[model samples]
Target: MNAEIIGIGSELLLGQIVNTDAQFISEQLSTLGIDVFWHTVVGDNRKRIMEALRLAADRSDIIITTGGLGPTMDDLSKETMAEFLGMELEIHEPSLNRIQSYFTTMGREMTDNNKKQALFPKEAIVLKNDNGTAPGAIIEKNDRIHIILPGPPSELQPMFVNEVKPYLAGKTVDEIYSRVLRIFGVGESSVEAKIKDLLQKQSNPTIAPLAGAGEVKMRITAKAASRQEAEKMIVPVQKDIESRLGNAVYGYDDDPMEMIVIKSLREKEMYLALAESCTGGHVTDLITNIPGASDVLLESCVTYSNEAKVKRLGVSEDTLKKYGAVSSQTAYEMAEGIRKISGADIGAAITGIAGPGGATRQKPVGLIYLSLSSYGGTETKELHLSGNRLRIKEAAALHLLNWLRLSLE
Candidate 1:
């Protein structure tokens, strides 16, 4: 079935808040074999919302609206939708009881205006909101379905998954599954060049490539009667692609490179330390951000200054004085130093000229050196990434971690 997501908030159109609900809804719908053709975001105005609703209803089988479900004057989603559908708004007794019980449990006074949350379109299916006071609802008219959810993601997400999903699941046919292979150290153009034939001939299972700062993600989606069938369909293609470019594909299906590196290190009984310069410790930040990383991550040295490199990671003054900080020699020494000092099984370093400044004629900005030091291996590679300071920093981090993933394997 075709669906449309309509996010009702001025903040979305004004770019104050991103419309994450549409993204969540689109992912969920794809799993249920529903194609979302349009994503509409309308302000908290009655006329505009009504126009959006009317447009969505005319073309889409299922219309999902998120936001503006609050107890305020600007919260006009339910009231406007009721008016548009020529339906009356009535207070749901169970919802009213839930709200009252909640306020009483907190020992707080329930104002009259709070009762507005209990109002729903007449004869609508009440969507219980366990996380918030604003309960959502589902209504069907003229063979078209309307699902209105609370504005807060905490409320809308759970209500959609637990209460609303089952209702919608029964009405759909077939199942769809998608797997994404995230590749680093490879340009999107090169990846496309290698897989252009497969992409061009795509039919039941669609292949799409998405390019970002310094990496490309290839998504393969298939439709089948069950998820197992879809996964089975993907296995052969996944194997073929892996065989061709196993060195570049770091992780699969929403797995970040840092997570893969961490997990691989755990499997190998290895610990890691980082000496970051261009990435400004973002590599350490990503690794430490994961839960239980303390078990494997010993220490991280952000030696942005030449003095810090010399003192913290034990880089020799002569090496820095000769080859400079952004050189591969400095990166190698930094990795070896951090590994020895921290007693970690592995040390990774990223030293680069990530800049709007500080680049020579031979070494331009975005020139990065990633080094890995391990018992059986010592490797260093250079990368030239593009973008502003933040992008260069982020890309440099991802590149170093992905290279660590390769070394671990």
Candidate 2:
């Protein structure tokens, strides 16, 4: 069924609040094999909301709305929907009891306006909101389904997941499941070219590439009778793409490079230290975000200046004088120095000119030197990236993690 999401609030139109409900609801609907056609946002005015409802009803089979279910004057969603659907608002006894109990439990007196939250359309399916006083409802009229939910995500998310998901799942037969392969160190065009055959020939399970900052993600989605069956269908396609992309494919789904590196380090019983120059300890931040990283991560030293590099990481003064700070020689020295100081099993370092500024005749902007020192030996790589300063820094940090991931392998 085709659906449309309507967000009701003057605050949303005024940019006072964000409409995160539409995104969450659309994802859930796609999983249930429902297509969302449009997202409409309307202010709290009754006329505008009714117009949006009329437009949605004329085109979409399913209309889901968030906001306007509160006790205040501008909260008009439930009443407007009732008026549009030619239904009377009836008090739900259970909802009223729950609201009264909430007030009683909090040791507060129930105001008369709070009664509005307990009212639902006659014959509508009441959606219980355990997180708030606003009880949502689903109304079916003239072959159109209108599901009204609370505005606050804290209330809407759980109500939709616990109550709305099951209800919508029952209407749909097929389930849509997707698996994403996250890749780094390859441009979107290169990754797409490698999997060009898979893209053209895909029918049941479709391959779509999503590109971001310094990474490409291939999402393979399949629809089947069951989630297990859908996942089973995705396995062969996933394997084919992974085989084509090889080590450029770092992790799958939601696993970031940092998570993969930390897991790998833990498995190998290895400890690591970082000497960051341009990335400014971002690599260390990402690693420490994972719990229990203290056992594997020894320390992070940010040597932003040439003097700091010489003093803190023991980078050679002669190397900096001859080769400059952004050179591979300095990166190697920094890694080895950190390894010696921290006594870690592995040491990684990043030095670069992440610039809108600092570009020499030989050393240009986005020229990054990454180094790793291990029991085997010290290795260094030179990279020339292109982007703004923040993007260059982010890319450099991600490259450092990817290098760690490869080393752990």
Best by TM-score: 1
Pairs of colliding residues, candidate 1:
none
Residue 287, candidate 2: Cα error in Å is: 1.7
- In model 1, which regions exceed 4 Å deviation? 101-109
Question: For model 2, how does the per-residue alpha-carbon lDDT over 1-409 read when each residue is reduced to its tens digit?
Answer: 8899999999999999889999999888878878889999999999999999999988999999999999988899999999999999989999999999989989999999999999887689998888889999998889888999999999999999998889988888888888999999889999989989888999999999999778999899998888899999999999999899899999998888899999999999999999999998889998899888997999999999999999999999999999999999999999999999999999999999999888987989999999999889999999998999999999999999998998889
User: Model 1: which ten-residue window has the lowest total lDDT?
Assistant: 400-409
lDDT of 1 by residue, 228-275 (tens): 999999888887777777689888887788888889888888899889
lDDT of each model, Cα atoms only?
A: 0.89, 0.93
TM-score for each of the candidates = 0.95, 0.90
